[model samples]
Target: MDKFIETINWCSLRDIGFVGPRFTWLYRKSDGSQIRERLDGALVTSDWLNRFPSAKLFHLSSSASDHSPLSLRLVPKPRSRMAGKLFRFESMWLKEPRCAEIVQEAWGEGLREASSDVLGKCLESGDRNTRFFHAKASARYSKNLISGLMDAREVWQEEDSKVEEIVVDYYQTLFTSSNPSDFVELLQAVNPR
Candidate 1:
């Protein structure tokens, strides 16, 4: 195992990494004792990593076999723009060295091709600029603006009109047309009978 790691490191290969079951290998002895450990993973060349930055390795359930099955799924293209699903990026990930490497590799080709490209640029720009990402992630502008129009259920059409109606009623109560007699009385406040 040591030799294998050494060889992979010497060759500049990187682990694609995986998620799911921590223990890939499980063994149960006749004495009623069981052992488990992560025994399966994939290592890849830099080129492969660059091509599939969002690629994920998921572990399948292990039943008859003690070793869990691993599968690789490529990151699909971003969804349609009109879907209203804006991308949210977390700046906390920038604190990790591996994250920077991933972002750098994702944009190493000198092209901002993927949605992740904006994130990589934000990280490279420095910590002070992280607010942009924070705002994007929070989406406060859109949310607050929509709040006055759309309610908690997100029913834009019906709720927006209801909100406008309520606002109109509120202002009308505050600034309703006043009687001219009230103004005439105020103008003659100092007059004697």
Candidate 2:
């Protein structure tokens, strides 16, 4: 095992961490002695790690064999558009000791500026942006507006008068109970579990 690890180190291959059980192979003896070992995994080169920073190795349960199966998942690199330019993540950046500190500092500065800008805009406007608000309200109203409705007889209604009648009739029928006292009979008929 030491020599094997030395070979892996010499090859510059790294193990992509696993997600499931610690042991991949299980052995049980008739005398009630059992052995468990992690013998299966995935190894990746630095280039592959750079390309797939979000790669994952899963240890799947095995029912027919003592050795569990391994599943490798490679997540594609994510690209984001920031200020009309593309931003990409490099896995090698994680090796830098100050990467986390630099990112946190930049994020904190940006967040402070953005928060102040938004608060200033809101304070200055103070709901005076009537056209934008009205437009959004009108858009929601238009989207929620029912163009047509189907009647109980399966007739399509497009006219405003007919649509209103259908809606009113629906609510009236829904609220006006024909047999209000029937709930007692329903409760009695339900068998206790």
Candidate 3:
């Protein structure tokens, strides 16, 4: 068991956390003694998580088995009914000469630069409309505020220190890559003066 855990840590595989019952397995004895344990989970690498940020794992109920089944949903639930429509590929678009250019421009630096310039202009004129800018800033601050978070035990953490700790831990785990080898290679590639 220890070796298995060590190997999992060594490979940097993390559990793509699930929603539903806390325990996946339930054992009940005839003497009225019952034990519940979370023995099943979906382990995934950081790259898979990055590619599918909206992926979800759900613990489905079981009638015959001791362990509940896990359902993995790659696509997230749509916010609106219209958003749930299935996507269809248009073959005619392949025949368009400018299709490739349009696609490249959509993902290219040109759009990014334009958006940055707009934001820069807004900030430059922010002094002229101080109240408007202040209101916008206040609204963003309120929207981004972290009031509370749920802990590993599924308990809500509302205290200032606890909330801060949870937020920091979450970001740390999210940003930390599963593979350390890439970091080493990246560091070696940089020329130190």
Candidate 4:
């Protein structure tokens, strides 16, 4: 149909970074008219295209459905495997009497006056350290909380009100007493300003 063709053309021109199979939708009527049109589409901004030059769109055929599937692919973003390993602190730093002092010392050392490049590196290191510490702390707290709940499984099995009360109190303590100072250094590292 004229409308379908116009729509495809309009989308193709308006959209940037389009690649792979062009057609999006295929239609066939019992009357024997086969119409294949690009009903589905994707558009990546110019900025994204420049940042991820190899990004591409993939079009797949539909075996059971009338519409074809569209997919986007790009190189996987890099991430640090050790970035959020939070449990380490539970065993290593949680009970250490000087843990707070150590953290403060590290914070001070990381942010001491330095060149722009050195400052940037220090900030990144601080951010990673903070993230790792917090993640571990949170995970430890959560695990303990879950264990406590599991211990009350028998009570909860008999009554829901008691379980709800325990849960409510746990959350109240968690939210109100949770300390952000533990990760302040990491936050400053990510945003020195």
Q: For candidate 4, lDDT tens digit of each residue in 1-193?
A: 9996687566533243234445777788999998887777665433454465445455666788878777776764333333663322233343445556655775778832322333344445564564545444444443343211222333312134444678787688778955555886787789545
lDDT of all the models against the reference? 0.63, 0.66, 0.66, 0.52
Clashing pairs in 3: none
Q: Give the poorly placed runs of model 4, Cα more than 4 Å off.
A: 1-14, 17-20, 76-193
Off by over 4 Å in 3: 77-193
lDDT of 2 by residue, 76-117 (tens): 424232235324344444544555766677587764333333
Query: If ranked by TM-score, best first, what sequence of candidates would result?
Result: 3, 1, 2, 4
TM-score for each of the candidates:
0.41, 0.40, 0.42, 0.31
| Per-residue lDDT of candidate 1, residues 100-177 (tens digit) | 666577678654445465456556768684654554433343233322333335443324457777667768878987
State the local distance difference test value for candidate 1.
0.63
Residue 161 lDDT, candidate 2, scale 0-100 = 76
Give the Cα error of residue 120 in candidate 1, in Å: 16
lDDT of 3 at 55: 70
10 residues in a row with least lDDT, candidate 4: 149-158
- Total clashing residue pairs per candidate? 0, 0, 0, 1
User: 1 or 2: which has the higher TM-score?
Assistant: 1
- Candidate 4 clashing pairs, residues 3+ apart or interchain: 86-136
